[model samples]
Target: MVTGRVARITDFGAFIQFENGEVGLVHISQIAHSYVRNVSDYLQEGQTIEVKVLGRDEKGRLDLSIKELQDAPEEMPRPRMIGRQSPEFENKLRSFLRDAKERGPGEKGGKKRKK
Candidate 1:
């Protein structure tokens, strides 16, 4: 369990300063549903939000979550917004894919063939 005061709000998420002198990030997507455009839309600096100890990483930093504070059950992840279009949507995506393909396979480029 951890207690903290909200320190700042940014496009990505909110930063909280724990009483024990540690900081944690509560990502905007994790804040709530309905597409959070800004973290300030739901939380502000100096506000207090309860967090559950999710787990710590190899660095020994605490990983906290706020979903525990909500009364309802968890919401399923949403699907991708693929079909949306623009004047050059398909062309832009084609260019992106081409660039990615040109970048080559994972890790260092070039592949070895069995002789």
Candidate 2:
């Protein structure tokens, strides 16, 4: 963990300068545990914040994260499955398939009827 001052804010993330004069980037996704719509909402131009050093990027630039220093929120419950449908729905689907088959190839609604 290190203390850094937010040097600049961009559309994608914010740039921070460490005490040793090293610079790093705190990406929008690492701003918070929840969704972040705007970077300004969570950070300012000169705000001093504690950040975790996730690692260096492919280009050797420092990758920092604020959310990593904070506790994560609880996981949301998964949605329930719809499961099987009613008999009426199954019957309707079968009837529709039968009608489509009866209308075979080159039929009025199925395809252009040959003269």
Candidate 3:
């Protein structure tokens, strides 16, 4: 683990400078385990942070991750269906499917056929 100061914030990620003058990039996905809509919300310019070195990329640039040092959040519960649908709803769905099959392909609703 090495200490680095955020040098710049961009749409993709943040650039960090180490004590030895080496710089690395902490990708937006590496910033946190959760969804990151904006990089600025998680990091700022000149903010000092501890990062784990993930080694160099194909271009030999340093690859770092802050999320690797932090514990992951608990898994969210999956949503499940609670009850069966009503008879009326089932009837409507069946009717709709029958109408759709009758319409065939590329046929728009309420469109009249040319002679």
Clashes of each: 0, 0, 0
| Superior by TM-score: candidate 1 or candidate 3 | 3
Over the full model, what C-alpha lDDT does candidate 2 score relative to the true structure? 0.91
Over the stretch 34-84, how does candidate 3's per-residue lDDT look in tens digits? 878899999889899999999999999999999999988888555787798
Candidate closer to the true structure by TM-score (higher is better), 1 or 2: 2
Candidate 1 overall lDDT versus native: 0.74
Candidate 3 stretches with Cα past 4 Å from truth are 77-94, 106-115
Q: Between prediction 1 and prediction 3, which has the larger lDDT? A: 3
lDDT of each: 0.74, 0.91, 0.91
How displaced is residue 88 in candidate 3, in Å? 8.1
Question: lDDT per residue, candidate 1, 40-89, as tens digits?
Answer: 87888999987766676788766666765666546767788877688698
**Candidate 1 weakest ten by summed lDDT:** 106-115
- Give the TM-score (vs. native) of candidate 2: 0.70
Candidate 1: deviation at residue 84, Å?
15
Q: For candidate 1, what is the total of clashing residue pairs?
A: 0
Error of 1 at 37 (Å): 1.4
Q: Positional deviation of 27 in candidate 3, in angstroms? A: 0.8
Model 3 residue 99 CA deviation in Å: 1.3
